[model samples]
Target: MHIKRVFDVVVVSLAAVVWLPAVAGGALLVLLTSGRPVFYRSNRLVGSGDPTKVVKFRTMVKNADRLVNRDTVPVTNTRFLNIAPDSPLYTRAGRLLERCGLTEIPQLVHVLSGKMTIVGNRPLPTNVMNALLDEYSYAGDRFLTAAGLTGPAQLVGRDALTDSERLRIEGAYCHAVLDGYRLRLDFSILLRTVLIVAHLKPSLSYTEVMDLIARNSGSRSVVALDEHASPRAADNTEVA
Candidate 1:
């Protein structure tokens, strides 16, 4: 774990340095195109059992949250799916940001600041966290790690699965974490995410998610994730 954290710091630090220009350029585009804040930072719950803000490029209207039609779909889930190659809500520049995954560039800052890992469970919104704790407080152990900008659940099928299923995969990943697992998962996530962004068919399935957990069980026993964990934990922050 120590080594993986160190590796995360080093690799993400370098990414931030090399991509600083693009990050800035993207932020500029958001600012110019949306007439809103360039960066969208939201209060999220991460490991250490506390709240943190996750950052991303602002892709929706500034008042999106207030206007979110919960009757349609949860906002957090929509945020992930909205980036699908066809979502019509994305601003022109937002489409380009999503296409290249540049919207996530701001998370490199979080990696540098020790607030998050390059790869780990996605942070949940504070409301989501409260709901999870209320329902399955015993699973706090799973939430004891820093929130990640990416993770195993993401690698398999983030947008494809229902929120409950996504949290199940994350819970499995957390329990099975060991040396080299983070690196391997991060690499897999990056490759898969890039492929999805490129509009290629993703090789993903529920069976694949189970297979990853099985391969990495490593003395960790599998327990069912709380049914409500996914909806409650959906939320993000910039590097602080």
Candidate 2:
């Protein structure tokens, strides 16, 4: 875990060249294309922590959450949520940022500040997470580690997974964090995330991804994951 934090610091430091320009350019785009409030701040529950004001470029209308969103599709078998690759409410600048993956550049601040990590589970909207927990109380296992920019769940887009599968993978990540975290696993997830952002397929199939996780699942089982019983843990502290 300590080493993972060190790695984050080192990597974020080296990426300053790209980070500075990207963040400035991203913020400028939002301001020029969209109106005021170039940044979006929302209280989100990340890992086992309290609600935090997560930062990102504003991607929707000023009052998007207050309006009914028509672009989201419900997650299969879960009465709790709707997710989508694109939303009708997204502003033009927002869509461009999302496409370029610059919408989250501000979040790098959290990573540098030790409030978040480069790879881990994502923070959930209060309503969405509440609805999820209302259905499956065990989903809380996700709080076991720090919130991530991307992780196993992100490797497979949301629509491709069922609610159970999502929960299972999330819990698996948490389990890995507690006992299975490894540097190699962290880089593997990072690489996979890059592939996805580039709109390229990962060299590993879904089964292979799951298998790699299982192989690294350490003995320090802290949570109950998997639809069957035990889950595959992270070989390294994957999302911390």
Candidate 3:
């Protein structure tokens, strides 16, 4: 457990050489194409806890968050404030930064400060968290550990996943953390995140990622039953 912190520091520090310059370049792009405010701090939830101040590159136009809600985006994304990658809300610079994952560059600071992590469940925007808590009784438990920059959910992405499946994968990761965290497990997720972002490897399917988590979870209780084992026609059930 303690070692994970050390690992986070080491991984983030080594990446800083490039991350600093990349963030700078990204910020310049935002300034040139959009305007002021290179970064913004959001009150994202980290588990079933109070909102933590998380820093992110400003990828949207001014007053963008105020304009969107769970059901208000011009597109059909039902999660994360219902904003899709192609939402018209994003500035020209915003689209590029988001596509490359550079929008989260400032979060590396929180990882170093122990406020966030390198691997765990991804933090939820307040709108998504509130909706989940209202609809799913066990939604809060999806946060067993602190929020991370990338984790099981990010490994598979939001498009290919049903919201229920995404929640289950997050719950499974929390279950593992509640059981015990393995350094090797977190490392693998982090490595896969970089590879996928770099387009070096294709994103894993939910089943494939679940298998990876189950294998390194170091517990018999970490089983994620295959959702595809039997198809139910609209009578679907979510994992707890």
Best by lDDT: 3
- The runs of at least 3 residues in candidate 2 whose Cα sits more than 4 Å from the true structure, single-residue gaps closed, are 68-80, 203-206, 216-224, 227-240
Write the residue-wise lDDT of candidate 2 on 173-195 in tens digits.
77886786777777778877788
For TM-score, candidate 1 versus 2, the one ahead is 2
lDDT of 1 by residue, 1-240 (tens): 776688887777666656799888998898888877788888777685667778899876666655543334544433222235565566788878876767777888888888887777877766655444543434355465677777767666566765445656666667656422445555665566657656684656755765665565552444344333343344321111
Cα lDDT computed for each candidate against the true fold: 0.63, 0.72, 0.77
Point out the worst 10-residue segment of candidate 1 by lDDT.
231-240
Q: TM-scores of all models? A: 0.74, 0.84, 0.88
Going through the candidates in the order shown, the clash numbers are 11, 8, 0
Cα error of candidate 3 at position 139, Å: 1.3
Residue 74, candidate 3: Cα error in Å is 11
Per-residue alpha-carbon lDDT of candidate 3 for residues 59-89, written as tens digits (9 for 90 to 100): 9878886787554543233344436788888
